[model samples]
Target: MGESLQSIVNLVDPYTLQILVNIGIAIVLALGLNVITGITGQLSLGHAAFMSIGAFTSAVITLRTGLPFSANLLLSGLITAFVGAAIGYPILRLTGDYLAICTLGFAEIVKVVFLNLDITNKALGLSVPPARSPIPMPIIVWVVAILSIIFVCFMKESRFGRALKAIRDDEIAAEAMGINIARYKVQSFAVGSFLAGVGGCLYAHFLSYINPSDFGFLKSVDILSMVVLGGLGSIAGTVFGASILAAAPEFLRFMSQYRMLVYGGLLVFLMVFRPNGLLGGINFTDLVLRAIGRKPATAEVNERHRK
Candidate 1:
């Protein structure tokens, strides 16, 4: 009993706190990815590129302008959103594997650009000052993540979200119904990129160091893994997926050389058993309403957004 109590006390340790921060950041990333890949049915493998842009943008802002953390976060997100809007307009024209390949190529281009840029310090990376935060890092991270999740939940039920879903479900049908496919797709990409930028900003500030390699192909894959592991369209699922994947490496530390093998095997096993994800098409919003003894609308409850 005493050991159990002692164990709980260790949850606030620096290492644990850092882990918490990582999980929160991952949740934020996954939330953004869901907007594109999950809801809009776009396959992107360059999410980390957007993240890197935000990281560098935030670092530069902090180092040069002396802005506070919140301002930097907002500015970075807006900048990334603009980039996404401009790039997504043309890139989102592709679909399926073609879209994935283009986005992946775009990621490599971003990485190369960052690696050559003098302001980013080239290959050596950038050392950033910590955010001028009013509260603890974990609190700030989780607060942003939680607010992002809530906003997504509300967004999911909004007309914009429904249009994205319609596009995802049947793009031709949606176009025939008068929905502007190109516009909605670009909007989704921009919004998702904004969230990814915010996540990257938080990550850079939390670690006080970042580099181009940090947001490479593998990092994009990792974020996608979280969204996949959780139900793709489910916000609650992103939380679960991010938490589990973020803590997985630490928990597997004892395995050393074999940890990655085990991790790969675990993901394979989960996918084989649950192809649609752990909670695919299961809306937590409906679950919440039911939990509180107020049944959600029949259409809402019956909605299945996952493909």
Candidate 2:
């Protein structure tokens, strides 16, 4: 019992805790992007750019001004959202391949700027201040997770979400119904970007490192893969997908050589066999309870139980 307690204590050390916190932040970032690209049917290949914006802005503010973490995070998110809205005004007007190309180009531009900027240290990377207290990681993770869940729930039930869905189903019909399509799209983009910015801020702090290469085209592709593999527009699926994708490489460390190749092949097979993804847009929680012969509420059972 003493040994076990010691082992558990070791696991709770500052570094390990920070890692878990960073993972939580990653989930938020991925989920926020998932909402925009997955549920709302917006295709942005430049999400990492927005993330960089948030990270750099937050880092600069926190490092230079010595502001509180909350203030830095909020300001960073807002700044990133503003940038997103500005970009959305023009880019959201394009659709299909046109939008994809534009976003990709935008991402490239951000990368170039980061690499060439004299003040950004030209790829040497920026270091964030060290965390102050023990259990900081857990505190940050819980805060970020709670905020993300709240925001997601708000968006899911809001009239805005319904409008976005309507537009996704058929933009022309949504517009015909007098929905302000452009406004909703831009709004979604800004909200999603803001969430991504928050995630980035957490990431920078956790790693205590920031670099242009961290937010590259491949990073965007991996994020998109998580959404698609999870199932477009499925919230529960996003969680499962993100967890799996994030942990896969680590879990398959034994595979060593062909780990990624195997992962890619499996993805291809999934696309062929289960295009909707492993969960089929179904919530894992609901599926688990159903498998054990429990339903949410059946009328016959309710009436008989009452008797």
Candidate 3:
């Protein structure tokens, strides 16, 4: 058993570890954003604002004060959550295109602030201190992954989560049911932004460097695309979508100059065909249950049968 374990350990290296770590970070970010935009029906084109906030907060705390990584990450999420909630109060009332523009402007404002901020060294990237040695990157990745899974599980079960679901189903009906729609909307955005911020902190530590430009409009759009392409309310779909979108460019590098063009074309086709995404709203858990021959609740099954 010892020899087998040693062999298994040898099979995984730092490069593989890094890839795993990045995937965890991506899942955390994509799923969090999906909760708000997909389930709650909010449009936030400024998620990168939360990301930048988290990155800068962790960087500053770790560099200037020598705080532990765990503390910095937690605090980063908290700070970003507060910011998200505060911003959501006024902006969530806007609908559709207006909301998108407002969030877009919020992101630009954040970028501009970071650009001129002296404490962050402006455009110069912050250098992260190395993590305590002996603990491999894969272990950290696993920890982050477990945390993300737990966060999603809890959110799915929580009352606030149910409120978001209600809002998604029908805002008018949810309001009629006495659910405070605005409160839930803001809470969803805050939680989503908090997770995105935490993901950013982890990403910064993984990359060991970050700049204002790194968290630009494209980053926000990329994350938003992951949420949309993954399906509005499906956690597993979001993960799959994020992984494919993030890795496709690199995987197709062999295609040379035309790689991007082909990749873009493929995306268009995917959207056209699988408009709801791979597992939109139906996560791996649901698939597992189905594979075990479980069916939807009796009422739902009966309703479908009647239809």
Query: What TM-score would every model get versus the actual structure?
Result: 0.91, 0.84, 0.87
Ranking by TM-score: 1, 3, 2
lDDT of 1 at 7: 58
lDDT for each candidate structure: 0.89, 0.76, 0.79
Error of 3 at 56 (Å): 0.7
Q: Write the per-residue lDDT of candidate 1 for residues 96-138, one digit (tens) a residue.
A: 9999999999999999999999999999999999787655566
Report the C-alpha displacement of residue 205, candidate 3, in angstroms.
Answer: 0.6
Across residues 16-107, which tens digit of lDDT does each residue of candidate 2 receive? 56446655776787777877787678888888888888888777776788677877888889999998889988899988788878888998
Clashes of each: 0, 0, 1
Q: Which portions of model 3 show Cα errors greater than 4 Å?
A: 1-11, 132-134, 254-267, 288-307
Candidate 3 C-alpha error for residue 31, in Å: 1.1
How close to the true structure is residue 73 of candidate 1, measured as C-alpha lDDT? 93
